[model samples]
Target chain A: MKRLDIIRRAGRNLKQAKVRTLLTALAISVGAFTLTLSLAIGAGTREYFAKFLETNVNPQSLFVVADKKLVGFEGGNTGPKEYDPGAANISGSSYKTLGQSDLDKIAANKNISSVQPNYNLEATYFTYQGNSKKFTGQVGMYDKTIRGEAAAGSLPKLGTMIGADDIVVPESYLKALGIKNAKDAIGKTITVHVVQQAQTKTTEELQALYAQGGLDALTAATQGKSQDVSFKISAVAAKPATALSDNVQLNISDTRAQELADFTTQGTSQHKRYIAAIAMVKDGVKPETVKAELEKTGLTVKTARDLQGILFTVVNVVQGIVAGFGILALLASIFGIINTQYISVLERTGQIGLMKALGMSNRAIGRLFRYEAAWIGFLGAILGALGGIGLGTLLNPWISRKMSLGAGSHLLIFQPLPICLLILALVLVAIVAGWFPSRKAARLDPIEALRTE
Target chain B: MIELKGVTKTYGKGGNTFTALDNINLTIPDAAVVAVVGKSGSGKSTLMHIMSGLDRPSEGSVTVSGRNLHDLKKKELDQFRAREISFIFQSFFVQGGDSCYDNVSLPLEIAGVPRSKRQQRVEKALESVELTDKTRQKAKNLSGGQKQRLAIARAIAGQPRILFADEPTGNLDSATGAVVEKLLFDYARANKATLVVVTHDQDLAAKCDIQIHVKDGRITEVKQ
Candidate 1:
């Protein structure tokens, strides 16, 4: 018989057994729907989660903690221990020094694109005023490591440094010190007290006393007793609110003073210590490669995924298990097709006999049955796939509304290859399921079939 | 012309082998009505199956129009059947749930007859059997006699050279069976095609131009 005739006949037969056929098709469709939805959802989740992480954290930056050997400390400095004054928090280097030499070696590393070394400093001084005040303050110095452009004014140049020694005071300081306009403070000189240990001689005290005269009369009066030293201010810099450095009340006057300052804090003071470096890799270089290089320096480097920790692993495992269950549902639907085809054969026995009597060869009979089964499977799969996509789209809003974290599910794009593969799989199952019944129908003896009531 | 030369069809193997057509040799001339009469399991239906090219003979060849039916491949035999052979069954072998017209149009459709022209041929064939008025009626709703006429209309719709009827009137009452038998012989006579009928009714067999008596898979008598 012609294929069109066979198809028409098969369609009529299905219509005859409408309830059963519909039920079977429904089972197959449900299986396909769940399978498709699971795969799409899993894919979208991965893409969305990865995108979220990328947005929240820097994609091309490496985090650097202090290398103990690089710290030049004899004892290993490891783990996070809070700085408690009662606890002997002795610094192997009195000065928090990751001096210029260490910065040079880091810059020379092959993958190192640009380096931003950070240090904090605190100092104390006597004021001209009778009352002495201690400056337990902090400072951070970075070289062009700021994340974005300053909202106002020209940015400081690459060589321009912000340190406790070169204080770019925050706007809060303007309010606290009763300074007028920020521009007026620029180029103005002020005396800051610098305190020293008892071992320092009278020459240092006299020098500090002379510098206090530069301070405002009130500040000068308080320096001799409470403030230890005074210094000349060169420039007052503009500062944004998130600035990382403390006020620079005093800076080294000459190379001799700097050397003396470095030596004084070398063995005992943990204050003014620098422990971390944050660097940016060049645009083309991968952040991962920089991280690997940093690890070799005995410093633990971290990436976004590392920081995300157990959450990333858990997401992947959950998706896998859910997909596995969906696969099981798909398999059961295939078996459901087999059962439906078998039942269909039993119901169509008389029809088979009639076709055979009409001079339909065994081959024609086989083709008819096979085509019937295949049509059922193909239609079921198509409807199921469409339903799956529709359901996924519908559920997207509900999921997103229920949990804001589920936002970004647009990552669940339907992949063409998987959909095609699913259709092909259904076709295969249909053909296989039809095989036995088709053969049985074809093998029917004409005389025996005619004899059937 | 149809000729069965020493045709033998055996079933099963080992000790269970039973010959359904035991060395049955017969010749049916063109444009003649022939009836094969036998009891149940007498191998009359087997004879029709082999003659219609729906089956293969195990030990012999069936020749029609000088071509060996046994020699044709499965697909070639199917085309041969669609083009030259047709069938009528006693229990009305119309596809159920379809209109009588669709059942009659089925063979023509399978033969790839053009739809624009198929209706005319189907109408003429149905009219030959006096079923033109019932064309839109479902086969399931037709009386036994009407369904048998519909089956006969379906069998002859493609204008085949030969028609095989397996107890074509067996399910009808005597009056209805007579009507169906008359229709079959009349159509075959008008078309000048060979007609082969298998029936247990002696009266039905008597109406044919020739008769073959099959007893226990063997033809015991052939009367002309």
Candidate 2:
């Protein structure tokens, strides 16, 4: 008999025993339902991480901080135990700071493609030319990793730094800068002010100044200096200034940030101290390998993978628990398939004998039963997947709202390709479950089968 | 033509065995109607099975249409039976859920006949049995006589050279039995196909051209 004919016959036979077929398929659907849900969650969480990584940083970039034995989210807490002199206190907790020499050591490595020291640039106020009214906001340097897409001008080319004279303004800053929009703001200049402390007069110098004039002269010699710098508005970034986010940030070039850092902390202890550094690994080199090299030199490094693990730790555990139930359900359903096929083989013994007497080969008889199992698997997976996807689609908005996730980001995302592959795999598993029963059916003696009544 | 030589079939193994057929030598000529009449344990069903290539003899050889059953591979034996032989059992093995047309076309479908060719053959076989109007009816809805006739239609649809009837009328009344028996004989004689009837009824055996009597696993008499 032709294979297609056998399959048709098998399908017809399954239809005749609808209750048994459905019960077996239901068993498999139990597993498929849970598995689909788990997979959706896994895909959803992973997608957010991927989107976050691309916009903020690249995979090759690792956040390098001093090996301070840090275990807290900056300034949260650290149960007091050890007090090392090397660990400097910031806000409340202590952490080792990255020094100039430490930066030099990292820059000298063979695998270090580039290093960008995270500079703390503080601008007291900023105003456009002819606009004396100054707006105080957050000021930071334009590191290439902060990939804020442009609203007016082009971003720096990949693997390059912003020019020293350039500063990027936000669309929201147009009103304060007296410009209509980003186009008008381009090529305009803005002034930033920072106070530079003067050197303290020594005792002998103070005594000579006091003798020359009075207390007034000494006071004049030790007063702080106020300096102002202006930079051209190069571009307007799209992401930095949203209406809801009132904390505006103005970005200056790396050279400008360095200049501000040099002058502001000229006499202070924080002149050469840095909070962290971002190291770029060379192309074709693994970040973890270089991270290991950096760790050997007492510098703590974190790759993107480690951060993802930390970020997804809770979600992953939940997924594993749900997937465990799915696996257990699948294991039980395999037996359900075997039992169903065995009962079918037993009930159809007389039919099998008659088919054999009618010249249907034993191989065809076996194929008929196996095809029935495959059909059951296809049905179960589709039903289960549809159920999972349907429920997920309906619940996604509610879930996001309850979890306080941002708009347009759902808690569950169903990817098409893996779902298709999952269905295929379930079908194969059903075939394997039907194996022994089909073999038994094929090897039955026609003479004995005919006498089975 | 079919031939059997020194055929011995036994059941069980080693210490305990029951001989079904003992050293039976028989030859069936072409287009002949023959009956092997026997009591309940005479192994008449075993003889039909071996001759139809549904079972093999424990010893000796059986050949049909110049192909020895023992020499044929498993696939070839199935093909040979599909093309050259057909059977009608006492219990009317037509599928109860199937239509009369589907019942008749079972042998042809098993033989891999194309769909375009099967419809004509099935209708013709149903017409020959005078059940053309009932072709669309399910086999279970037919009377005992109609069921047996449907079995005959199934047997002859593929036009096999040999037909084996194992108590073809055992489940029907005399009038119904007579109708089934007449259709079987008329079709065999009209088509010039060999017919082998296995039964315990002496009256049915007498209707055939030849009769062989069996007792205690051995042939006791031959009437030709």
Candidate 3:
């Protein structure tokens, strides 16, 4: 018999037994649905992580910090360290901050184009109109490379001078100031009062005092002597300005930042030292190579790509496990296919005998049964894929909203290649499942089959 | 011509062994209507099965149109049966789920007749059996004689060289049986195909041009 004829006969047979065919197809559909959904979730999560990394990290820049082990005895120390009055006490250990000489040494590398030092600003109160709010501030040289997205306005342009009159606030700062929109706070001038004390104190000592008596006692201890400086709000970012809790950041020109450091510690022997620096690698230079060069100077370097890789690995593992379960479901469905075909063969014994006596080849008879299985697989896969995509699309908007992942984001994403492969795989599995039953039908003795009631 | 020489068929093995056909020898000329009359268990049906290549003989060779049935491979034997022979059973063996047209079209399809020609041939075959008006009706809904007529249409639709009917009118009333018997004889004469009928009815057996009688799994007599 021709292949088309066999297929037609198989389809007719399946139609004759509609309920059995439908139930068997449903079993296969369960597996296909789960597998497709898992793949979609994996793709969506990885895409989201990639976007986060792109928006928050600069590919060409490396974060350079003092050796973490040598920075603090809390990390574990081999011996007692010499005491330096100018050293910043961080986490119960006094560590030398990055000085001019250290910056010069890092800047001498051939691949390093520029280095911007981060400044530690003292606690101060900012008054806008009649409302005064105390906030801890950190001063940094304004550069276009700093990683943060603006809710309104834009970051300070590269090579543009940011003097004492310029500052960048956080989203929380705007909320605290009763501003409903980020764009409304742009170009507003606020007065920042820097409290200058008569005596210089270690960072740890200052923190202890602030914890004990709040900012009011520290203000009184400074004899109320403070200098007021005015700065214009340049931009508002979504993330907080500094790692410090509740603290906002002020961006100023390097010259102005140096001037503030000198004025804040002028009464004592302490001098200006930077907490950390960001090294900008030139175009076409590998950041890893530059990181290796920087590590030789006793500095720790990290790149955004490394962090993104770790996140992607985690997503892949999760996807693998979910897909594994889907495969198990498909495996179970394979047995269902086998059982259905066997029953069909038994029910059609007399019909099969008639066909054989009509001179249909055993091979043709086998192919007819296999074609029936293929049809079941095809229907199941289509139903499963459509159901998975439908559910994903239905849940995407609510999930995005709940997770605060901006509009147009989907938590479940379907990629075409893998889904097509999944359908093909199901068909192949169905064919395999039909093999034994088809063989049994083919080898049946026509005389005996006809003799069966 | 079709010939069966020393053909014997056995079932099972060891103590369960049973011989269904014992050294059967027979010959029927082309275009002749022949009947093999026997009681149940007399192996007349087994003789038809072996002649049609539906069953293999344990001993001897059967040949049709000068081709040895035993020498052909499984696929070739099937092809030979499809192209040169057709069958109608006592039970009709119509696919009840299908339309009368589909029931008649099965043999042609199995013979690999191109789709373009199958409809015309199937229509002509059904018309010869006077079932064209009921072509669209499911086989299960047809009367006993109509079902047998549909089976006859299916067997002759492929225009094979040989036709085998095992008690073709056994389930029908006399009036309906007469109509089916006349249709079968007329179709065989028009196609010049050898017709072999197996039956216990003396009236139907006497109508054929030749008759063979069987008893105890062996042919007892032949009359021409």
How many clashing pairs per prediction, in order? Answer: 35, 0, 1
Candidates 2 and 3 compared by DockQ, better number: 3
Q: Could you report the DockQ of all the candidates, in the order they appear?
A: 0.28, 0.41, 0.60
Docking class of 1: acceptable
- Which 10-residue window of candidate 1 chain B scores lowest in summed lDDT? B88-97
Task: Give one digit per residue, the lDDT tens place, for model 1 in B101-142.
Answer: 889888887677887888999999999889888989889898
Give a tens-digit lDDT track for model 1, residues A1-453: 677778877777777777877777777777677767766866666666666555444566665655443322244555556554322233532213344555566677777776654433335532222224333433223333333222222335532443333323333344435456665544443344334333323665556756765545334434333233333333444332222233333332333234334433443343333455666677778877877887786565655556444344555677667667766766776677677777766666766776665567787788777777777777778888898888778777776555444444463557778887887787677778778887887887765676666
lDDT accuracy of residue A89 in candidate 2: 64
Best by lDDT: 2
Residue-level lDDT tens digits of model 3 in A127-244: 6544555645455555556455567767654434445567777777776677788898888876666766676567887788899999986766656456777778877766522211
Sorted into a CAPRI-style docking class, model 3 comes out as medium
Q: Where does model 1 exceed 4 Å of error?
A: A50-54, A62-107, A110-279, A283-320, A357-363, A405-425, B12-17, B112-120, B132-137
Residue range A363-432, candidate 2, lDDT tens digits: 8888888998988887788888889999999999998777655677776999999889889988999889
Q: Where does model 3 exceed 4 Å of error?
A: A62-109, A114-146, A150-279, A286-309, A415-417
In model 2, where do residues sit more than 4 Å from their true spots?
A: A56-61, A65-101, A107-321, B134-137
Which candidate number maximizes DockQ?
3
Return the candidate ranking by DockQ, descending. Answer: 3, 2, 1
